[model samples]
Target: MSEYHVPVLLGPSIDGLDIRPEGIYVDATFGGGGHAKEIAQRLDDKGHLFVFDQDEDAEANLWGATNVTLITSNFRHLTRWMKYYDVIGRVDGILADLGVSSHQFDDPSRGFSYRYDEPLDMRMNRQQLLSAADVINQYDAVQLQDIFRSTEK
Candidate 1:
């Protein structure tokens, strides 16, 4: 159960970058803006941090830092966004926290953890019609097995 506001590996991860005060960085998965906030703090006025998250709820976590640019889109289009901002080849480092945040699990309505038996809407983007409930209720046992197998290494 990782905390959302608290970054998973703040110090080690940030330290590994050897961040330049005036360099550009990208937070590809800005779940709660924890990593982005840390990066923004390290950046000088010349530095820029571009953070991306598809879930509209992530927008609320954005800080009022001039160095931080919140992009309301999935990180899958990272290259496209970088090109649009003209920072494609200039990024000093990229950080991606690719895991479900505790913020989602703790919210009973989100239906991430099974402890709360709510509508199983395990979607990072609620705008999507497909949901965990739809998958479980509609998908046959064979279909579920196939899906599970697809995720195997």
Candidate 2:
């Protein structure tokens, strides 16, 4: 596990899933694979889990899992990609723990925090073109305010 990463609401989240051994599950936010690991442990050989993380670094966490499918893509494309993987209609459970991870906040270069003075680069998907810097520097003040208000609600 990365020193900066920590799973949140892990026990309660897994318990709420009410996992079925033969079912297929999806973890939309596979930050450090903490929750995915726990879910995998409870799954039988027939069970399947598709983990999605836009970050390429997440692949490093997929060492020993046998029945897992890791997708290096944003969760917004979950339905589309699940269908591509032949798991759209067969999905038995879906778990999405949304929001930024602890590591993102701790890493000063990621620019997710206001606590540190760094170049604003809060692209959860590093491959994406629109980052926090782009939003702040390019968007008009009204647009920025609108985004902030919408996200707050």
Candidate 3:
């Protein structure tokens, strides 16, 4: 595992998959490729692995020699990417390790964790324009109210 992010609950999480040697799998959030590496290990030469991650930094940790397809997009659009890649319903298993990675939480510049008093820029994809700063400083009263109200229930 890369120092960028150490995958939590590594063994139990991967073991729970009950991986098949020739089955197709998806790692929805391939942070640091720790879990992905394990999944790849269990796969035979005919097996395939598809990894999805919105954050760009995570790409640096992916292995090039594996039969893994890395998609640079959020898992919310899993169906779209699956169809685009022709995987669709062919996937035998999926492993999603969600939430902020250690690299994002530990780094103050990412502005994800409250431990650091950095810029209020909490965007998973940096390409997006709406940030935490924009919500706090630019959103209208009605917009802010709607946001707060949604969390109340």
What TM-score against the true fold does each predicted structure earn? Answer: 0.89, 0.89, 0.90
* Highest lDDT against the true fold, candidate: 3
Candidate 3, 17-100: lDDT as tens digits: 999999999999998999999999999998999999999888998778468988899998999988998879899999999788
Give the per-residue lDDT of model 1 (tens digit) for 19-129. 999999999888888778888899999999999888777888876888999998878899999999999899999999887877888889888899897888988888888
lDDT of 1: 0.87
2 versus 3: better TM-score goes to = 3
- The lDDT per prediction is 0.87, 0.87, 0.90
Best by TM-score: 3
Screening candidate 3 with a backbone cut-off below 3 angstroms (N, C-alpha, C), the clashing residue pairs are none
User: How far off is model 1, as Cα RMSD?
Assistant: 2.4
Which parts of model 1 are misplaced by more than 4 Å? 1-4, 141-146
Per-candidate RMSD vs. true structure?
2.4, 1.9, 1.8
